[model samples]
Target chain A: MPDFDFHVSAFAWVPETSRGWVKCLRPRWAFEEAGFAYRTTRLGPGEGGSDGYRAWQPFGMVPAYDDGRVRLFESGAILLRIGALSDRLRGWDDAEEATIASWVFAALNTFETHTSRLTDGLPGAVEAVSRRLEALEAALGDREWLVERFSVADIAMATVLREIGETAVLRRHAGVSAYLARCLARPAFDRALQAQFADFDDSRVA
Target chain B: MPDFDFHVSAFAWVPETSRGWVKCLRPRWAFEEAGFAYRTTRLGPGEGGSDGYRAWQPFGMVPAYDDGRVRLFESGAILLRIGALSDRLRGWDDAEEATIASWVFAALNTFETHTSRLTDGLPGAVEAVSRRLEALEAALGDREWLVERFSVADIAMATVLREIGETAVLRRHAGVSAYLARCLARPAFDRALQAQFADFDDSRVA
Candidate 1:
């Protein structure tokens, strides 16, 4: 019942492997980097399926955000909103901001879109994911980050790459693997991952 | 070269079926809605694979944008930059802008991601698309556009829906079908569609 400036929705618990892998970590990482204090509203059993939750999150997905004035869903959108509100995370200029947006889309639409389907164990999915990873590895080249500096784009991309971290397809790209290591090395990322892991119940380990 | 205020990348030619379906339509539609006159840099064969094009567009995809000041790739990102620049297409307020961003991600990450995979004809893919489409239909109840007014969110969603327009999966949702029709009925969409089709050669009819 406290008047928290920012509130992000998450699940009450997730399986063991999914402990720190929830999409909610995106917002949590952003908030940590921004040095912002925010509260989390964890959904109970069947809450995500309720009509009220649907009104907030059209797809019953977690990581929806409310910033006192507006409600926003989609981790990519929420990340952008967080960047806009946080001085530390925002780009230096409008053009830099556009670059950030471009990388965000690349991470979600271009990369995650393919990586998410790999679990299906389809040949086509493997090929598709491989093609995109090659492009991403090429895109990364020698740049330390997706944009000028560490931003939400890296947060998005790193999380996506982490989801498929153990795959040989991703392991082949040494530069990408190194890049992921650098991103995960950030203290903020550790804070965010631990926060999400803390929310899960040890009794329910899937 | 003429000093055009804005420029967008596109393919010099695509197959007949893919003519209007090219993602360049997204930016063209946005420009039309904004009443902005922009030039198109049509990529000839092998150009998308070139190092220069890759520098501008990491994935070497079409619909990259340049406004003399900054360059950006990804249709969703380009749409957002257009919204920021155009008075007509942008949200009325900052909060409304956040809403537009949310829907844009929903269209690209949520909907297009699944629809794109359907061409592979995987069962899991079909079920995923159906679930998301049902949510979309339910969320879209009694609404003409994704946001308050017709914005880039509509452009992204409309284009994504149109890609799967002929599929029974999409057609099953009456509300979503009507929404797609409403979006296509726009003069800007028509203009953008024809503009893309005009760029393709008649000989390539795939």
Candidate 2:
């Protein structure tokens, strides 16, 4: 895979609590789903702030992406780029693409905002997340995916939901809990998880 | 105008504090930028929860969009769709499109999450937003827009930044402040603001 043209940047090491949860997994999962061979450019400790890296990722965040075609950062945006390149993950048409993009924002911005706060145990966060989950459950309504088909929206959503998977607040929304299970059960997710952990191990410094 | 193909939904009325800051203004501004004729589907009091409205916008938020081509929610997503539809607001090519999308997420998700908290005076929120604004100021560097040109990404970023327009935290980032000024100075933004306030005035309930 040395010749792999697509590249997604990731952290070589993260704290034990964050090892499996780094956002690089979003693009890594998308690559797996798209069956697109890609490599990870691992940034170790103290390496994220290099002027060059900041040029690629202004916030110096993980999961900056580049292919010969384009270079960009933000896991949600990286997922969209991969979606554009892969038919299986993209909307079947313009209208469907709009729906997919909507869910992407919903997952990353609308839902993640509350869920991340809940993860941090911020005061009043539970109520915010519960309200969102109720809306999500209704929106899901027996659907296995956030849209008509499994797309990058689910990838963004599943990753965000994973932040709260252990919480009693999440357990209360049976429908949403089931949806998260269906998303996480995908083979691509497993591969993405394994690859991220392996990177953490292989890139560990002495 | 009665037969305009594009429709952007807006709240018919809002409290005085929220009159000009509604999310619907995002799409309204985009429509103005594209010079596309569009009508507002005004949602009156308690109208957001109607089953049909919920179907269009799962979270019952304002600014759900419907054109003959596609119908969707999420202001960020709606802006992307408008960018796709209007040449002036889209990228020159695929690579540029990816950059625009990245900044859109950067604004809506990354920056908004922190800035919104800072606006609410959440404890420790200022520090979080300050760090992001510094990075953003560095990123803006001499650029007038987040991407190569004025696009929906700027729309998203500008609106989020407006949340903290009055804060000393924002005033400290001179580069970012200038960049935001350039975005707000656009004639489309003024039109969007006028339309939103006028709607609030006309739609007031007895």
Candidate 3:
């Protein structure tokens, strides 16, 4: 119900590739699913010059959000703000919410660090992702999801995992592969993926 | 007020050289200042081993905090939770608060990265810190503090800067040096420094 606008740096979405794709695409999916009205703008690369996408982010990054009142830059911060605005994302109690917050930080700061290295063509990308995947597998041991039922933590991690979904590291983990399927089963996530990626495929062929 | 207890694993207050001295020391300081009862535990290097700290944090990092209700890691998240509980740290308004949040991320992710490299005895530490110092100096030009008034962002950055306070990089910027002094002027910060480093001076003789 709260008015929101997001400005993202434009990229040809590869369904799994691109620098800011996961950050730019996922929250939009979550917001629309929560039945919130929001507008999105994609700024071309270097369109804003030195300011770049920082017009939307003081820190000069993409995936910035403005809710008419507060403008937030960090992707994790923006996701937290959106979760606070919607009942669909947060957990039932403060403890659950705090736990989810821990996982969110872990997903980005810990897990995603390995993921970033993997994507950046670093030497140890495969080994690093393998270690993280093993950890995620152990954490998910015999469980369907990270916490009880589905929550924002799942969304956050899934977005990152989706980046390396095609890699052998994730495919080898039966639980993680199954979890990815469950995340995509959500009609909201499916729709967002299709809409966001459709233009990229079209551009590539042209 | 939230009927919570904080269990903090920290180094025994030395004086100035405690790792995570600022973060681990501040909440306790705030709690004591607020008349809240809490428990403190000390963990020494090589005493707990790898699994010890990593159990609380996958990164094997320090200054992890656990409330009876919910366990939270990451200083930024801990600070946000503490700020929400009390208004002592939030800035003048929502925008200012948002600015404070960006600075918190910037300090840790951007400024601290360069500062850490500078302190880590790397080959290019000096050049890296010098470049970052110039950038920060320009950003802080003519401003007394990061924002109009002091907030937690200042606390976070001041603590990070303490790691390299004695470096020539900081010495080169008169404004940054003055800014750090202003942060240290707070009685709370002074007590934190004392609690953190009092033992280090004696250890030198040992």
| Model 3 CA deviation exceeding 4 Å by range | A2-22, A50-56, A118-136, A162-186, A198-206, B1-4, B11-38, B44-60, B109-142, B159-187, B196-206
* lDDT comparing candidate 1 with the true structure: 0.87
User: Weakest 10 consecutive residues, lDDT, candidate 2 chain A?
Assistant: A197-206
Q: Superpose all Cα atoms of candidate 1 onto the true structure and report the RMSD in Å to 1 decimal.
A: 2.9
Among these predictions, the greatest DockQ belongs to: 2
- Looking at model 2, residue B134 earns an lDDT score of 93
Which has the greatest TM-score? 2
On residues B1-206, what C-alpha lDDT tens digit does candidate 3 reach at each position? 65777676565434434444545765554444344456656655453335656556544344577868777766766655665555566577888777766676566655665576577565566886676566567667688778787666677678778788998778998888888888878877766555555423344334
| RMSD to true structure for each model, in Å | 2.9, 2.1, 5.4
Find the number of clashing residue pairs for candidate 1.
0
- lDDT per residue for candidate 1 within A41-152, as digits (tens), equals 8887788989999988999999899989889999999998888888788899878888899999988998888888886565677888888888888988889988778999
Each candidate structure's TM-score, on Cα atoms with residue i matched to residue i, is 0.94, 0.96, 0.73
Note the chain A TM-score of all models in turn. 0.92, 0.95, 0.80
Q: Which wins on lDDT, candidate 1 or candidate 3?
A: 1
Interface RMSD values, listed in order for every candidate: 1.3, 0.9, 3.1
Q: Point to the candidate with the largest lDDT.
A: 2
State the lDDT of candidate 2 residue by residue for B49-131, as single tens digits. 88889999998888899987789899988898889889789899988898888999999888988887888788788998998
Each prediction's whole-model lDDT (CA): 0.87, 0.88, 0.65
